[model samples]
Target: MLLALILALGGTMFLQKAFTPKLGLDLAGGTTVTLSPVTQTGQSPPEEILDRAVNIIRDRVNGTGISDAEVAKSGDNIIISIPGVGQSEAIKLVATTAELRFRQVLAMEATQVPQNLSTEAPTPGASPSAQPSSTAKPSSTARPSGRQSATTPSASPTGKALSSALTAPTPGATPEATQTGTGRDQTGQKQNNKGKNGTPTPAPSTPPTAPPNQDPNAGINTQGIDPAVLQQFQKLDCADPKNRGQGVQDDPNKQYAACESDGSAKYVLDVAKVVGTDIDTASAGVRQGTVEWIVQLDFKSKGAGEWSKLTTTAYNAQEPRNKVAVVLDGVVITAPNIISPIPGGRAEITGGFDQVTSTQLADQLKYGALPLKFQRSSIDTVSSTLGSDQLEGGLIAGIIGLGLVVLYSLLYYRGLGLVAVLSLVVASILTYTAVVVLGHNAGFRLSLPHIIGLVVSIGITADSFIVYFERIRDEMKEGRRTLRAAVEVAWVRARRTILIADAVMFIAAIVLYFLAVGGVAGFAFAMGLTTLIDIVVVFLFTKPFIALLARLKFFAKGHPLSGLDAERMSTEPARTTTPQEA
Candidate 1:
């Protein structure tokens, strides 16, 4: 028992930074984001696509080093809960489609679009080519919008209405895709207006300025992109996520409108020259002599030829077209000038990226892109203070339950009750140590259900002691053995019963853990762990302590209060009766 306690406590103390178990979302505070699929062409994507998207999202969340984060699907929506994360950071981290592409910059134009422009679907018969006049002079000043930049035009009801109709919803997008939020923090509150119906509502603040790596004068193919396409580019805003209007998931063989994530500028990008699937592997590292973090990309054999071809084209092209844009989900991540053809099948993206952002990018690149886009359905956040309250309540409930068990044992079993109480303490120590160690090393957080599981285990441990005590009393009542002998015989029977009972419990827990979803699985896991601990404590501590106590005079003599009085347990009373019998 001493060795067990030492190993459990020592291992936990060594592995865990803190002595406490990690808490789940409800008890530790965090952010949750829900994403629903957006089909490309009015038909639902294949099951494989949705499954692959889930895997990609998992990789993306894991890239942030959030081991306790939970990602699961409910019906059609994918839910992501990240403990100890903020709303803005969580959204920025997991909300991206990460559909990376290497596209040429065809044209750059600045035109302002109204914030309240309705993003409604166009009439079925409307001409596909109908667009705003290309003759309109370009504005020099463009403000950041969402994750893109477009010149904000003077407010005109006519212009707003026209822009609304022209920039229709994607063919298969939800009629009114909307994102709601449980704003427990400033970041969450700010992101509450992300989506309304199918429209991209304006954010209260302008997007951040682009990093220093972005070149303002990167050459664009002014002669290549049609004026109408350029006009559309002028209306685009990267700041408003919803502004990625109809057909934004462009065909690989066609020109497209896109923006920089920081809303620094907008671009008319040529067809994709290279895609994410071409990447064989990606990793983030600091440059040899600099503190700047970079993402190194390695391509597969076929991708090598493609990469060589793309680089050669960029190297030979005019100014902006010579700069290949690394675009993700129609937003330009970076556009670096091609100085020479890179045929080595490897390249590095150097930006003013910190370790966190670089690592996130590398993970996105390493995992293949999602086949379908997702609209942010909702975001929820829990404050740490609230989580603390929940944790406190759970702890109080558990303490009360434990106290009741201890009280019952002491009141009923007399001296042996001390043994039961001590056994419980030992079990609790082992359980706590196990939880903490598992939480630290295996990313197992103690959620509310898991806490309940632990509390319920009090009964399980107490039950084992009760079984052994009763069996020992039964043996002594037969009057064929001393207390020591009774204990030995009782243990043989009790051990089998204990094993059978614990086996049933462990099997049930195992089944639930594999079949159940979400928090229930955590509960199942905790239950199984404690059940196993119960068996260990009984064998290592409870039975051994009982045997030792039986050897003591107080217990072996069957003192009335020892809870093991052999005479009191015997069915036959003492032969000598009182005066009434005489």
Candidate 2:
């Protein structure tokens, strides 16, 4: 037992650098971010929706592998506290809505644009050379009859433009494509234009406000994409950090405007043709035979049908329309062009994703999205000094309790008190070593409540020692046998009581640990741990040491200070004889 104790201590110290107790936010001083749900109608969301949002947020935070994060809901706000995290990380984890939506790309533009192209603004009469005339007539050859057949391959002019734009790879294009799904148009125009002065010109206005004739309900209607939304997409400056914040959710059935997460591009996206629920699973891995990481998506039965129809429409649409936007939390995570009518509802997002980013995205898709959008209402950093003061106070209280237990044993148990004190020292050493090792490997934190639990355990350990000693002295006082025999016999009887007592505490601790949350759970965990350690010390150290001491003249001969003076005890005849016979 001594050897085991020594090995544990040595191992913990040796691995101290790699494994250390993680402190809670209250102790470590980390970042706290509060998020309030943003409802478009200016009223709080339904309680069920809010509850689901909290759960989704919890899953996302857990997926980040941050063990010390606490996600809770207070009133209508969700509060997230992460220990050992910076403000930026805390905000990133909680603020992201992760509401995955699949929308068609109505238009794409360079985020840096000149002048607010607010559709609400009157037409500007600038130089004919500088301002591309918005009213330029559609060429005769490109414009198709309004009654063009929907079934024929090239029936709809827009469909011909889209199929030609999205399916064929652009000349000189590299294998690595940005997630913003754009390729080339039939007109041989680059989907992305590097505009002058960082402000590029707007995308061609919504195609003549006409729904594609191929599938009258191809559901690919441009008529609903408000010109104002298009203007907002045109004016969007991806470089501005302020523009990156979560915004109001657009009607899922209407065209919406959003910017790419990296601020690389801005886009006008068609309403939701697919959403997170339609997705069955998503995984991230290195592309087969390549080093690049990509996220692969698989859709459910209904989602698959929608995905196929959406891809088919996108494949047959014009430049920006051929692209599909992957929006998360009202922000464009990526937009990829439909290279083909993707069948089977399986697709790959092959942006310039690294393993870490791809894995993160995959996690978000697989875990499902939050039901409500959240905006960061407040963020603050907590200092460790307050935690340090509380810890210091707890330690002082624990030491005082321990000291009292030891002092009482000395005064009452006499020479037996020495045994009790030594046993306690051993238990303490064992408990400390176990906690440090567990903290390092299991992410256990030593909170104030846990400290109190440990203090309580000191008294419990002393009680076991007292029980065994008193039993042995009682046997000797009855003149039944020698000290060694008394020690041996008393242990047999005392162990049963000790086991039952410890068992009750152990069971209670287990129940409390599982049923409680927060700090109370921490206390229960400590209690359970120490209870087991007390058992180990009693069997391996306490019993053996007491048996060994029973052979010493100091105790066997019943010295006054030995706490078992046979002369001072009752010298009654053996219990087999009655008092009248004696």
Candidate 3:
């Protein structure tokens, strides 16, 4: 069964076309990015801020399911190394400041390039009479069939009527850009001008200005909004990437015009009611009684009161005004409508979220906002040749170590050495297959430290064989039982010792793996894996094979070359009772 299982796993690897284990940055070479801190004041950022950024960036990378990525703090800069070339998405994820804010949705419009603005420039002093081509009305009560309700508060239940408004597909919408967690209009075709990271890069040009008399919020209530903000909203073309506001640090005291993360719609959002710092904690989970993924938020004491007030105001407002926008990185990720007053400090943001995206959003929110902003200082591609040289050195060292262990086993055990050698061969095959399969499925990668761990396992495996063989020899020297009987007795005693030793090593590996990071963790993981493999081989193959060999004529009769000769072992003389003594 074990052989068949190995064969099946091998077949799966072949089918998946994963011949080699994924290598780490030190073994395969990857991209290294340096991010320099950009503080509000031109002074250098403090050490704690840099350390905080490092931890957050590392969490973001791991949350994306990319293994073997390293994030470290240098002098006033953060360095990230990912185990693949052209990791643009990873680069963007780490570089983004992930500043989250909750603002009321003042007005919304479908993202479109105005035909007049595209064809001809607007006349200089004439009143700009062109209104938005299409206005998107808020539909917070629109629920998709067969899905759970969008938001449900612990204090007050809103029922199914309140759905995720942003997830509802807007008619006549075009997909031009990519957002982290926002829903897309599947009915529209994707645009071709998107950059490699799925962010649209439109042609660079000045945004057309509106006349002084124009009111962008013409029919809406613009009570608390500034006139200047309204003018900017009137001229803002969300379809243009430059106007989408990628890295702008929006002030919480001001109103702003922002594009949806997916660029499906544009919105004029009110002043921030709750900021990212207000969040006490955030997490992602599946909704009870349903499989829909959602992001749950818990606000701080003061923030909770502010959130309640914001939800109450939105619930009492008109169509579009009833929705609240969740803005991150100066872009609206989702704008769900307020169905009822959500008094509790806790809330959930549900939409077309999958497991990966939900976790990513949760991580960004949980880590809180960075104390300082960052700009990409340099992106350098590491050469694979360097990795190759390091890998070659590690492999050579492992080979030398393995060769010595095998040589010692053969010389000391004589004919019994063949069994030890075969056991080693089986253990190697099992380890290699496991590493390859795990690399393909779990994103595990082999690094220099992992190589060292594998090499050390050679001695561990050989020690198991030596213990059992010595126990058998000791039993045979007593001249009480035959070779087969001695084999069974020796195994009973040896296994106890073997288990204890392996248990100790495994425990140490587990502790080390959890406490360490980067290459040290890799080493611990590899050691633990091989240690388990060693136990499997001993119980399933080594012990059983020795039992079968004991039944052979050469071994049963204690042949000299078999390393089980009676003369070789100091056997006690047979007891003969004298006639008088009897």
Candidate 4:
């Protein structure tokens, strides 16, 4: 059963196309990004803040399913090294400020054509309208728009309308309008919006609010906004690259104008009622009995009351006023209408989300907001030539060590050495197959330290065989039992010692793995894994094979070459005939 199970697991490597174990950044080479902190006061960020940022970035990278990523603080910059090439998305995710805020949507305008509206079949033999009809105004009776329910597949008129607008040029948009926008589209497709100098124009900062936080609903009353700010909003085109709002930092105390994440729409949002700090936890999951993905949020105690108040106000408002915009950084990630007041500080944001996107969004919110902003200083691709050379050297050393172990065993144990060699072979096969399978399924990666750990385990495995063999020889030296009887008696004593020793090593490995990070953790993991394999081989193969050999004529009769000759062993003194026995 054990051999068959191992073979079955090995088969999965072919199915997963994971023929080789995943290599770490040191071995495979990868991209490294450096981000310098940007503080409001133009001073260096404190050490504690940088450390916190490193932890958050590390969590975000790991949360995205990338393994063996290295995040560390260097001087005033944060350096992130990810294994493999073309990891642009990971680079972007780790560098994002991820400032999360919840603000009331005062007004909204679609930037792209809605998918449903654009794909509608025109009437046959009917004249096509020159212009698309305007979307109907949302009403109190309307099903909540923008956000999709987790249990349903029904499209949201608001969400579909916004997402559709991103694909093609907006109707009636001029070449000048399109050429002014510079960032990639919501799907990460780069757009051609370079300036006459062939460089991208920086996004302009959001217009400052005239009266910040004075009126809670100031954004809803367009008259209350400064003419210049309102004019900026009116002229802001979501299709324009500079207006997509990628890097703008907006103050939570002020009303701001921004485009949706997908460049589908634009909105004027009121002061933030709740921010990332208010979020106690965030997670992504599917609704019960449903396959649709959703992001759930839990608010802090004070934030719960504020959340309830915000929802109640929106639920009682009209049209776009009833919607709440979830702004990350300066972009509106989503604007969902509140059908009813959501209490208890728990809320769900459901839209067109798959497992991957939902988890990404959840991780961003769960890690909390960074205390300071960061700008990417540079991105460099590391070379693996050094790692390759190191690997070659390490392998050569291991081979030499293994060869010596095998040579010593053969010279000392003679015929029994063959059993030790076969046991080593079996252990190696199990370890290799297990690591490959785990790399495919659990994102395990092999690094230099892991290699060292594996090489060291050879001695650990050989130690087990030596213990059992010596115990058998000790029983033979007593001259009270035959080879067959000694095999069983020796095993009874040897296994107890073997289990205790392995147990101690396994416990140490577990502690080290949890307490350490990066390469140290990898070493501990490799050590623990091989130790377990050693136990399996000793109990299942080594003992059983030796028992079978003990039944053979050459071994049972103690041939001199068999290393079990009676003359080679020192026996107890012969018992003298006692008077009663004689």
> How many steric clashes between backbone atoms does each model show?
20, 11, 0, 5
Residue pairs that clash (backbone atoms under 3 angstroms), model 3: none
Per-residue lDDT of candidate 3, residues 1-582 (tens digit): 668867977997999998898888887888999999998788898888788888888777754232678888888888999887888877877888778888997776655443333222111211111221133332322222222223432221432212222232221133222223222222222224556776554432332344678864545566666878877876777767776555667888889888865455677889999999999988887655456677888889998899889988877777567778888888876676565666657777765577877876787788767667889999998865448778888889888988888788777777788889899999999999988988887778788888988889889888899999999988877745677778889999999999999999999999998778887888888899999999999999999999988777767777677777766676553222222332
lDDT of 2 by residue, 1-582 (tens): 676775867587676853345666667777778899888798989999998887777666544222445679999999887666574643675666556788987765543322332222101111011211233211100111111101101112222111211221111101112223332454425455334644333344333333555532233235557877866765676667666555445567777878765454567788899988898988887543245466777889999899889988976776657667777767765565554565566665544467667777787788776777777888887776458788878889888988888899888778888888888888887787777776665556666667888888887887788889888877776647777788888999999989999999999998887676566777787888889988888889989998888777777777779877754465653222222222
Range of the 10 consecutive residues with the lowest summed lDDT in candidate 1: 164-173
On the 0 to 100 scale, the lDDT of residue 213 in model 3 is 88
Give stretches of model 3 more than 4 Å off.
Answer: 1-12, 61-68, 101-106, 113-215, 222-235, 248-256, 270-318, 321-324, 336-369, 384-386, 475-489, 514-517, 547-565, 573-582
Candidate 1 overall Cα lDDT vs. reference? 0.65
lDDT of each: 0.65, 0.64, 0.71, 0.70
- lDDT score for candidate 2 against the true structure: 0.64
Off by over 4 Å in 2: 18-28, 40-42, 52-74, 83-91, 96-369, 383-389, 475-479, 551-553, 567-569, 572-582
Best by lDDT: 3
Candidate 3 lDDT trough over 10 residues, lowest sum: 120-129
Between candidates 3 and 4, the TM-score winner = 3
RMSD of 1: 18.6
C-alpha root-mean-square deviation, each candidate = 18.6, 15.0, 11.4, 12.4
